[model samples]
Target: MFSRLFDALQGGSGVGAAVRRRQVDAEVPNFAEADDVRAAFFSSALQHAKSSYDAERDGYVWGRTLRPSYALQLHPLNTVQTYTQKKEFVWVGLTAGPWFVGVVVLQFNYFAAFSVSLYNVESEESWRATSRVPLPGPWLGGQWVPNEKGEFGPTSAGHRVEFSAPLSTHRARLCFAGRSVQVDATGVVAQQLPNGKSAGAQRYEVHAVATLPEEFLGVVFPLGPRRAALVSKVAAAPLQSPLKLRLGGTEWSGDGYLSMDYTRGLLRRETRWHWASATAPAGYGFHLSEGAYDVDNKSVENTFYAGGRAVLLETRVEFHKVTAAAKVWTLTGDGIQLRFRHADAHDAALHVGVVKTDLYHAWGTFDGSIRVEGAMYKFDRVAGVLEDHYALW
Candidate 1:
């Protein structure tokens, strides 16, 4: 099956065959416009394209797919991310220097309901937003303004009758009003961003904290009364990301989330692997080799969407942390360092049904104070490393 799809993605050209085409708009980057929030225009565009992949296309066995970032599927979405800020001064330690925090509160369904906002923690004090950009499918949130109530309701038409937005290095100030929540985002955690010019692609620091008022806790997505029913499978708060890593005096935190998983499936198969070896201004360099694979054999895909960019790596990554390993059971490759110190290690585990599983996860946080990558580190109780021939999800 993988051989077939791999061959298809490699060269197969047909209506049903997967076709990879990256159409980067040739227009000059409007640094002046999208430069600030990176929006060349004041509008946050919604992008929509018709394809045979719709659910209506029906049954497929060897035909599974994955979606990375929702920002990529926006209708008339802005080619570049643009941020507009309304400042409310907030004091900082000053000793730590100025801090940057951005917030984007997305209001779906409502003419102006919610927005995903990014606020520079040290730069501003508070901001309120109302109203939305005139777009199709979902409403677009440009710059957040100060407001509580605008309009709330389901969309009239579109593939996604509901609304949801991504957040990175941003926070939210919201509370339920009667039935809807007000977008008064002020308590969101600070999001981190990658410097970009280095070896890997994603770089953002954000701590996600949600305040679900009593009324909203039972509520599900999709604004309509019939659709917004209580969810069946309840989980605990703070569902840590399945992946994150740190190395060589630098730390990399990852959260490859998929917002709209129709069937609530966790079978991730499609994704790519990246091997990055970068040197800082100082000669001290580091190597970052990471990627998502169907380690669990979910027959689905694992991916991430940051800054409105979608990155899909081929599933089944091979990691040879250790030079000599007899074989990799569930692990494609292994850490050459049989056992190391995970001094700053954190645990992110997932429990499914009657059995508990494990996932290959380890990382060290580096602050550029010393040689960190490959530096000897130890790990505590690990999580989610499923040992199977391929995948068992």
Candidate 2:
């Protein structure tokens, strides 16, 4: 059944040709136009848009014309009519005391992958594990249910996500092999901006810091058609949360930094990006990304959040690896500079004929400064992750 499904999705002719055609049709909007469009489109929608699900569109539709928010809203669109173009996931990162734990649950049409990692901040000792479940059905795998307000959130059984009134507390759990990992958090909205407004949908961005409980256990864990030609739109926020973690009979607790990434889209066959986020001080957050998937360099994702405000920067970031081993590297960008020396790293290469992924993830620190709002915020050492990823599916 899996083989046949793969053949059905991958066997068609002119897939590459179709992708090229779409690339031309979907030229990214110019950076100069992005700000004006976002302000005009999102401000109106946020004020007057009524949120309602469009079964025909397979996601929430907002505003007078009933614009689809699949591209912008922080909700899941699992019921998209184009089954092959749908991909969705929720990623959470927790850093507290001497430990950092990362958890994720991802669903592509052909399979679902769950991963958990525990890292020690001081020593850089890390343990990571992953499990893959082949999914060969029209329903795909898990569920992503929206709130009463039609906002994108997660809820699942066995492994579940929940929320409290006014969307204050966001909670999640993953259970496998009689062990569990859980997150109990509360988010404070910092800044909200327009992500982009397109003919198909209107999108916006939000920055927040989610506060988490000191400690919890269980473990669990994209774009384009052609099985790889889609783009996964993302809304990510750096977090100010506390954490208490228990894994493999060991426990640790401390004030931590967390980040949430909510994504939905179809991805292209080949993709690359640079991503890093950190809790530089007790209440300040730093995040930066440069990726092929972004509409352009002006993506709101490239900014810093401090004191509940965001400072958008004009950044040109480059990564220079100092060694062939790729364990030590320097990342530099306009108004930003950092060095990452991987204490421990994870490398995975998976290929199944037409599908391929090569991913390297390193947890490290940034020793530099970021200029925000014409002011420089310096850091001798700050905790974060550096990732080099490539995928063709």
Candidate 3:
């Protein structure tokens, strides 16, 4: 039954063939709008109608097909118009000097939410602000805009994002303003996957750097899926960016790591997961994730990127909490083992009648080893994040 469902979700045809056929003489869209550029960059002809887990391969075969486009055109499997129950989001984070800044834009059926956070590595200080607004209809409408770049988020909502291109090297801008906090920043993709096509089981990813010129309070903050019931799609990229920031009228600059995350999908009533990633010296980066959405650990999102290539790992990862406060945790897998001690943390709880969410994100260091493709890489102290999230809707 699952195989049949997976086949159906892949359009019941050779996905590569179908995708190739659709690409014949297809010219990339020419648009001036940033949103339109993103839409074209992510757009795909495949429809994700169901979720499938491949036990033999220990991977989750995405129901959505990947093609050469600027935007993703994702459709829900069911006809129900419960927009609020559906979720889509784009999150970006960057580290500058002794500070880390993050931006998130989330859209549901009836409303949109935005968040901006800043963390100080030396003082272990963290601050976050969030807001939400009502959305009357589907966020982008359900149609593709030809020769134009679609827009994401409204200025009135206190957050907005724009992209320069869909594939290869690109640039993006994130702007936010609310109360005493205001930020405007730009991210330039220095390197990315050769093209916008999937390589075997790996998703598209990029490396970027962001810049912010102004200061907010004591910090110059610049930063930055599909599914059925519980369907999810995620793209993870490691970034090497240098940034200049101002805090309390003081200027600072340093090299830092950055990451971009985009997700869209229908969700189950309950969900939980453990996810972690980090960038190290010598162009080495790693990503690890495990949980309910991982489909029995078969669809592991674990990979190591080195020397401009990515190596996907087949392993089991476990997360052990050393304390209830979650200030310390242990992560172990077939070829990886690491310990994390939280340096800074953020927690949020939201309840809107039938829907509820709890999130904990910790920034810290990992001390251990990661074996990629039989080569063991060691880390004495590598800065990164550990996140635990749960939702009930």
**Residue-level lDDT tens digits of model 2 in 242-360:** 45554434444556455545454344445676666665645455556666434345333455655544444556667788889887888787777778777555567878877788888
Worst 10 residues of 1 by lDDT: 86-95
- TM values, all candidates: 0.23, 0.62, 0.59
lDDT of 3 by residue, 1-393 (tens): 454333323322212222221211111212212353334222331133122322233222332222111122223222232343445565666654566666565556455555555556566555444444544344321211111222112111233443332231223344422111122433221111224221222111222343221110010000012233212222222233445554333456666545444444444447787877665543355667776434334323566655545565667788899999898999888888888887655577778787788988777777898888668888656666778988885
What does candidate 3 score on TM?
0.59
User: What's the lDDT for all of these models?
Assistant: 0.21, 0.45, 0.45
Question: Which candidate, 2 or 3, has the higher TM-score?
Answer: 2
* Ranking of models by lDDT: 3, 2, 1
Better of 1 and 3 by lDDT: 3
C-alpha RMSD of each candidate structure in angstroms: 21.1, 13.6, 16.5
Candidate 2 has an lDDT of 0.45
Separately for all candidates shown, the number of backbone clashes (residues 3 or more apart, or on different chains) is 88, 31, 20
lDDT, candidate 1, 162-202, per-residue tens:
22334422333322222122222322222223331213222
Off by over 4 Å in 2: 1-83, 136-142, 148-242, 295-300
Instruction: Please give the lDDT score at residue 326 for candidate 3.
Output: 90
- Pick the TM-score winner: 2
Descending-TM-score candidate ranking = 2, 3, 1
